[model samples]
Target: MARVKRCLGIDLGSHSVKLAEMALDGAGVRIIRMLAETLPVGPDATEEERNNATVNIIKGMMKKNRITTKHVVLCMPGQTVFVRRIRLPRATGSRLHQIILFEARQQIPFPLEKTIVEYQVFDTEKEREVEVLLVAMKRETNEEFMRLVRRIGLQPIGISITSLALFNGQDIQRINFKDISSKSGGGLSGLLGGKKTTKKKSKKDATGEGTSGEGVDAADQEVLADLGGVPAFEEVRAYVNIGARSTDVAVCKPGEGASVGFIRSIPLGGNHVTLAIQKACGLETFTQAETLKIEKTAVLSGSFEFEADKTLYDMDACQAATQICDKLISEVRRSLDYFISQPDGVGVDVVVLSGGSALLGYLAGYVEERIGVPVELSSALGNDQIKCATSYGDEFDYTSFKIAVGLAAQGLGIGRLSVDFLPADVRSMRDFSGQYVEFAALIGFIGAMVFFGSQIGAESEAKYKLTKEKCEGFTQKNTGGIERARLTALESKRSQIESKATVLSDFVTPRDYWLRFLSHVYQSKPARLLLTQVVCQPNYLGVTASGATTGGANSGAPGASSGTALPSSSDPRSGIVWIAGEAEQLNVINTFVSDLEQSKGASPNQRCVVKKATLFRYSSQAEKSEYFAPNPSIKFLIRVEVQDEEGCLLTRLDSQPFMEQTALPAAGAAGMMGGAENGGDPSAMGGDPFQEGRGGGRPRGGPGMGPGR
Candidate 1:
């Protein structure tokens, strides 16, 4: 088994720090531990004080969780990083690096030398243009984060933004859910009831009327148009992560290859709601207001009214929280509107909410009602790829650790974006660490060479001559008359054994040629192409002779057909293979022919087994056979000429008039060459080579030819 790797993803947010320990192996990624610690510093604390608090909290969390993984992936706050999607010409290597660097200089507010810039190129529908997601951060901020990681005895490998991390986390969860659903055949829809599953309607149904004159109302049609009818906004999803001090929004196109199309950060979050509650209730401390908000506040949406027994303080807290939420939702709406107004923008179909504040009661409902889109609370606990240990407790806050999970997923090579913000000095350190073993081995080699050279130089001339003479004397003594005679006898026996083995190999090789031929054909066939018939003939002239047969049980050989005689001087290893198949597309047939022509032996120097592969006959309007009903497909017949490993068939093929004869006539002429009534089964021509103790014996017919009718 391959070695298992462990990585730690740290989310250093304003309110708390989250650390997720992930174990990755061939099986998949598993969450070994997740720990969160709140920062004790107040909002008015200095930067140095906040940094100290963060470092101390992370240290405590690691010690409590017993996490020994040193490699770390850190998530930078979205507000601190600048992210832009730029269009550039398709390039690679140094050219691509230069282009991105130039773009970064123009897009980033900071100077190039003082910023850490990373870009990821995305695939687009355009042929010549590529979309690049460029991210930049101040070098000082990056160094400060790295220093904090080092202070905690961890190695920082990658730095990613919160918005991108949220996108990645949601994407991986959806993929894992789909994979599990496929395997179980239940789709896990009942488990994730928060998500809306929109059923696609046909053109007639989408046009708002049925054949019986029953029609959908204007409101329903408008909703459908908003959801999916627009071409530029199809299948888009938004991931909203509301942290303590800010909210990150990532608009993405979701499908097999999901990508973030737009990203923005709003400076309103749960902290604003806490401050609002504090000011409304006239609380002495912010902590008291936070407690009141968590205990009594619930955002009222729609027609939900306050309870008759509710206190004035409770009402005030709820109203304050609701007002902050309203403002936050409005900001999110503005961001989405701005994105949709762009030329290449896509409308979000659904919003998935995550973060520490997403756990608030009725928040998802409020967001849904305000944003006019379906909302779901993101939970990593139910994801198939993330395995939680029993010690983590059943009440774990899965949503709050989403960014950490996404960062760890990127470290495990599961995320789509491949951006890294490690400085050059760190990269050089990692590279040197990776090659330490190689450097040690090289130093050892030099040391051994030097030691041996010194020893050789220290040896006396007389001693060297004595050692050489002793070795020569021993060789002379060993090669005397009896030894020479014994060596010659051994050589003679080896030669005789080799000659016998050669004869046996030649006899056995032909018996398995049909099996090899069939195996190669099966392996080369494309998934869309289905074979209907296959026939092999030893030589071109023998096809006519085989077709002349009816049921001559006593023709030539014991296994020969009733009215046909086996071709004389036929070599089984060399033959013409005829294949007939049906394909959904013409390209599948062409792909099959190309594979056969390019197929070669295991060794690089060995020649291709197929001398030539030809498309003998093709018909686009071929009738569907009884086996394949309803839909018609393209029918094709291929003629593949194969040669023996020894190339003996090449001489015979060149000497014969094979090329002058068309493949279709020969295929029809040998129609009766592989039939069971002629004492052979077409399927048994390649007798199971995998079966043990099999011999070099033909199956009741001439070598290489199977019975057909």
Candidate 2:
């Protein structure tokens, strides 16, 4: 959205403070509202007292009117400001500004540094000169007004002189001028003109006769009285604003290459008129005089007509009104005549009356009559061309709102001539502060956006967590039964793999014991010994070397000194060891037996004894030749036994590390046969054949069978 600009014009005066708000719509300007409040104290009051009163009034007015805008322009009372028209040789803009400052130093009474100066330049097409309307005010006076505005929470955008503001007010109204011939009463044409002066030259002795009127004849009267060759529209015009305390006279000639021709302020105003009336009539209070001036007073009127209580003070009012009006008229005429006396001065054209006192009865007509010019009363509120907001009252005194409206017009960029006396440094600081506020608002907006974005993200994260938990719960409920079935299948597969591993381990382990026994035998035998056959059984008992006869028992093997009968060779549990080999000498056979008894391969608690050793000589040449013996050699059969610490036979299959400890006692042949008939394989008597066990040989039977046949 595009921003709309609103301008507020404030008029500070001795008697009252006025505010006028205006806004531009397209090309037209509309007056939003106007407010005015009388000062609580008089002119003799301190600045603090005046400012406090002014601040309170402004605050109440803004609140009551609901004024929201802060862009404001102030009107400096003409009395406090210095206005000058300085003409300079044709120069560039930069040079012109410097010339004006120099001019200010020479022309202005105040020090250059102590004043705030502003200017507007007008170019003359016919002359090589530029006229500058310079407006300057004391820095302290400007600051006082600025502080007053700021105390009411407003910073003015511009500070303008009251005369320019009054001119602006009249220009915006476009007041019409009446047509009048040069011969009109006292040469009172459209605008104010200088009084015609007549001179008669006395004839000397040579001529003896002289005309009474010497200068201009009747035919040249218009020419002599006319303002020097300038057009009526461009003719010098004056604005006489009769404020409460002083009257500001400003001359603005629009087209004659001049904006503000000149401006001056007279110390006489409505208050003076009222005081004069009070002194003449012997009024007890000034308030009654003011009331009389407003009600029964008529300036320059011979008879003052009272609307109320006519019998009491009619004559006195009449005398007072005439005397005050005569004095005011003399002052006004002198001011206008002085303006016209200047070089290249066209003098005041039309007089526009404003300010609160301009509303005094017959004051405008009396001034027009005395100064021989047309006087028009105008105010910001009363201007038909300017639209007023609905908030304004119809009875509003538009006269008092002139300066404020003019100030507003300046701020709205519609003034006829705009000049500001605000110091450059102060205006720059105000602009900077405005920019700072805008920047801060932008930062706050961005921060709010970021905060909201974070809040949205947090909400999304919480929703995601809730959704994830729900998914986990659903999976556990729907897939639990299938998971149990899967566990069972895995367990069964694990058992089969474990059984195969055990079988492999058992086969490898038994080889250690078998190799032990064979190594001992080989080490003990002489070099000529040759073994063709070997048998080992756990349950067998062999004949003892002591040659004592003992019972053969599968449960317990008798001592080596007590020979015992051996079990069948195929019964691995008989704990018997047999060997058949050929040797050339008997010593070799006896040495092998003795070494076997002492070998580490024997059972821990028993000795390996040569229970029987049979030697037979070779009966056939084939046998001898097969043995590879040239001399006679015998074939020997030897049987050895080993026992546990308790003299029980050491079973062959049970010799494995795994088989050493059992949950059930080892079964005999009858139990083994019975287990086979029931359901178990007879080969299973050795348990899992490949189970991890302590043994040194391969299985004695087929792949799936045990040692015993």
Candidate 3:
């Protein structure tokens, strides 16, 4: 928490929002905070409400935490997006995009206008010219998110498919969605040959790079945003995440060496089972049904054995699970067939099954028996190399956090792949059906930011290899060549720096690398902020002077506008307080002011971030301002105001005063760069970014920077 250099990732799931925060290090990505909060409107939510609710949740989170993040890498379920496998002769610049859009209309059931498109290309085979993975999602969904982000107080940088993060974390290449179980048997071991396994691969693109480019999935170029594990085989492997509502499968095939490949997502999820079970049991509540479904051995583990739960009294749990299992099998089979139908015909070596639904013991074996594909099982067992706490009771399961872990792993350049930030159009499920889907859109707005990064293990072997040249070129044992020894030591430092710097560069730009790290680092920390609204007006941005304790007229904390000459200097909270602006800008300004006024601050888990994004109402008696109304000319300029937790505006005078800067960020503070605590004060002279008010803020992660890079 020393500096304000933190990154955040969010997973807007069916039931809740899973968030992970990571701290970067010299070599890898590390976990800092983890949190999960429920999304209202119940389990069977609708897309409209779900979308709306999701946005509201995001806004609330950003507002509460005072997060002004712009580089947000979000995660979407693969099932929700469309994936198609096509054949191409070779890698081309924009040609692939053009072809995919045309093909997308044919492959995706929705009309062309309804969705946005993107694609990933893999290597070629005998019968198949080359394999290209086409991805698409609803266009409205994309716009909804962008608008919601603007509506709230933050920006949406990248929106990725959740499965990709998991795939990136698991280090999967082109998978035949069906072979997930084989991965559990030992697929990744081969890819991660050793600590020194980073010897570049031959996968190439039209650009001739060493093939690890994943920012935009290009032909021949491989993706690295998958769960990292000791390679199980030399061929190719897949990770199948059988989630509560959907299943995501990723395939990693090494052509020459380690790189990314085509990825696909489908809707075949656990909801099918839940629905079947609900019908069978005539269940009323999703909560009770979910509990009954997981605890009982019927549908999940693929085992017919019965547990000791008394709920199995009236109905036959085994039979219920059996019926649902039958249907589930068909769905999975279809997904697999769809994957196999690719021109390259995914030659999956092994399949590793993870996620909550995969908790079913021997499920991989069952899949293998049914599909003639080797299958293995893995869980919230952390990345293939590290481990996290298995703390949740039966009531709550952290096992569902695989995607988040994988995302952090990618975001941080920690575990495996570089499939980081993405457009919101990718879908993770085949069907997103539910009443909550409506409210879901609003409640799950927190879904937009996903963290995919990694934590670097202490690979002494890599260290040795890094300095081998230096060691060989030097003298030893207090001997003859002192200068040579000094040169060698310097070379060693240079080597380490070079190695780490490469990783650092990978984590920052090019998007995917950074999100991979986030998947691993961000988990359940509970420290989150929700931004309900944000106004990036003309004169409304900047940080002013303030102590740990705020004073003077309208003077809240650090990040606040100096104001357009307040009506009176006597206003107790002044020095530089914000008043409501005119029209939309005015409304937003007043909302903040009212929020500061209403009282009762944040709870222990949350805080507020009030920073000015712009400067509004700078009109003179002589000329008209840019944003000022044409005719009326902002007759009654609604100046910036402050609101409390309940959304009420605060007067220039309020004892409880919102000096509550602890859980919240100082208004207008950028990075950890203010004079405030961890970073600095938001309103210091040079620190007042809003004084000039170029942009609202940088990215909104947290109050302090993540680990050192």
TM-score per candidate, chains pooled:
0.55, 0.51, 0.45
Query: lDDT value for candidate 3?
Result: 0.45
Q: Tens digits of per-residue lDDT for model 2 on 361-441?
A: 667766776778877876435445456777665666677777888888777555645576655676666556646768899
What lDDT does model 1 reach? 0.65
TM-score of 3: 0.45
- In lDDT terms, which candidate is top? 1
- The ten-residue window of minimal lDDT in model 1 covers 207-216
lDDT digits (tens) for residues 18-99 of candidate 1: 8877775434457888888889976667888988898889878877767778778887778878888888776544676687
On TM-score, the leading prediction is 1
Model 1: number of clashes?
A: 10
Residue 303 C-alpha lDDT in model 3: 37
Q: List the candidate 3 regions with Cα displacement exceeding 4 Å.
A: 1-6, 46-71, 91-115, 121-131, 148-154, 172-205, 208-235, 257-268, 300-315, 337-343, 346-349, 360-369, 372-374, 380-398, 413-709
| Candidate 2 structure lDDT | 0.58
